[model samples]
Target: MKAIRIHEFGGPEVMQLEEVPKPLPAADEILLKVYATSVNPADYIIRQGGNDLLRPLLKLPMGLGLDASGIVEAIGADVKDFKPGNKVYGVPNFPGDGGYAEYLAAKATQFAPMPHNITFNEAGALPSCALIAWNAIVDLGHVQPGQRVLIHGAAGGVGNLAVQFAKAKGAYVIGTASAHNFDFLKELGADEVIDYNTQHFEELLHDIDLVFNASPVRDQSVRMKSAEVLKDGGIFVCSQLDSPFPAALLQVLAAKNAIGTMVGGGSISYTSSLHGTTALIEEGKVKAVVSKVYPLAEVAAAHRESEKKHVRGKLVLEVAKEN
Candidate 1:
């Protein structure tokens, strides 16, 4: 099988397309004939060894992908939920990193049946981003109808879905994006849109029930400003910040008596642990927004596009063309 793998971490140039052996399913896993996979920022971060603390866990000659949609070609002995020919989509286990290939062996619990209404490419775009959004807004934030929720980076993959998920729950959703993306975010069900380039969101919105910071602004200063916008007892869910309070930020969070939680946004354990995202997709309450698609060989280009930080939605790698 031909898959993209990087023997060493560095730049996009390191992602080499090479021949590799197909993976076999373990007792609780399923072997999938991958139809499509999507690129997440975590893919590039892992490629560069950004999270060095996790280096010991990530094997070398690593495959680089998190989300995919495909058909089950074979199921492991203990996998009773699915069978061969079942259409499925989910995130594969991270550190294992095998989605950039024609086939992957994913734990059965991480995936869910693909919705009949969507295509494989669209389903492929949902897992990582949608799961992050769901875990933040619905699961942890416990957003309720009539409450106000603010999502930073509203036009990006996770933000787009967060907007939709908040709206579906009947929360009045506010999102921050560049001026050009205002209409797009509004279309995604954001009740209010802040142009981050021109306006300070903290100055304009306050007493929020939930604040989701999906941007890369992890500095203590920025977090301090964000903390000001939350109502007393409100929750702030951040993808970039650790939840345990890094001593410095702990002071600020304690000053406001606000709740803080870190949502580890991307997980490969979706095939088993995060299949709930698939149920949301199948139920039509949520949908994946794919802003771009590239062929398998152009994985580097896909990474380049993702680096732009202006992507309105998810980007997918078309590993296998539809018949």
Candidate 2:
């Protein structure tokens, strides 16, 4: 099998396309003939060794991808849920990343049967981003009907899905994106769209039931601004911890008897959690929006495009050509 591996951590140039041995499945795993895979920020973070805790666990010369959709070529002896010809989509576990290749093995629990309505490229784009949005909004945020939810970076992968998920829950969704994405966000069911580049979101929106920070803002002062728009006891969830909070903000929350919490790490347990995303896809409430596709040899270019931070949706790598 040919795979893209990064022997050392650095820029996009470090990713190398090389011929590697095909992976074999464990007793509870399945070997997939990969059709497509998507690139996520986690892939780059792992490649650049940005997260120290995950760095040590990363195998040297590791394969570079997290999400994939393909046909099951073989299944381990203990796997009964899937068969050799089943279509599936899943995220490979960290420290064993191998999606950017012709074939890779994943625990059966990490994948779900692909929906019949979508193409392989679209299926491949859903696992990581959709799972993150599902976990954040539906699980942790506890978004409900009639609620007002604000999503930052609404044009990005998770943002696009987050908007749809919130709307599907009957919430009035507000999204923050540049001017160019306003129409796109509206089409995705965003009730209100704010141009973050020109306007201060905190001043324009208030009493938000939930605020989801998907951008990479890490400053403490900057992060606390989201609290300004929250209603009393409202939830402020952020993917990045480096958000700024004012002392006055804490006082306000304390006076109102409200709580604030920050969360990171969308890594699924690869057990029961993956099933939830699968069900959502099958039900047609959620959809993967693939913005671009690159061939196996163009993995480096795909990464470069993702780094621009202007991509409207997910970017995928087609590991195998269609028949």
Candidate 2 clashes between residue pairs 3 or more apart in a chain or in different chains:
218-242, 219-244, 220-243, 220-244, 220-245, 221-244, 223-244, 224-244
lDDT of 2 at 249: 63
Root mean square deviation (Cα) for candidate 1: 2.2
* Tens digits of lDDT, candidate 1, 167-260: 9889999998889998888777889999888998879988888998887545565566677888888888888733344666666667778888
Model 1 residue runs over 4 Å out of place are 241-244, 265-276, 279-283
Output the worst ten-in-a-row residue range by lDDT, candidate 2.
264-273
Error of 2 at 233 (Å): 1.6
lDDT per model, in order? 0.82, 0.80
lDDT of 2 by residue, 1-323 (tens): 78888888888889888888888999999999999998887777777775755766877867878898999999999999999999988887655566888898888887888877788898888877777777778777889999999998889988898898898889999998999999888888899999988998888888889888776434455456777778888887676533445677677656655556554464544434356666666788767788889997888788888877778889989887656
TM-score: model 1 vs. ground truth: 0.93
Evaluated at residue 102, the lDDT of candidate 2 is 89
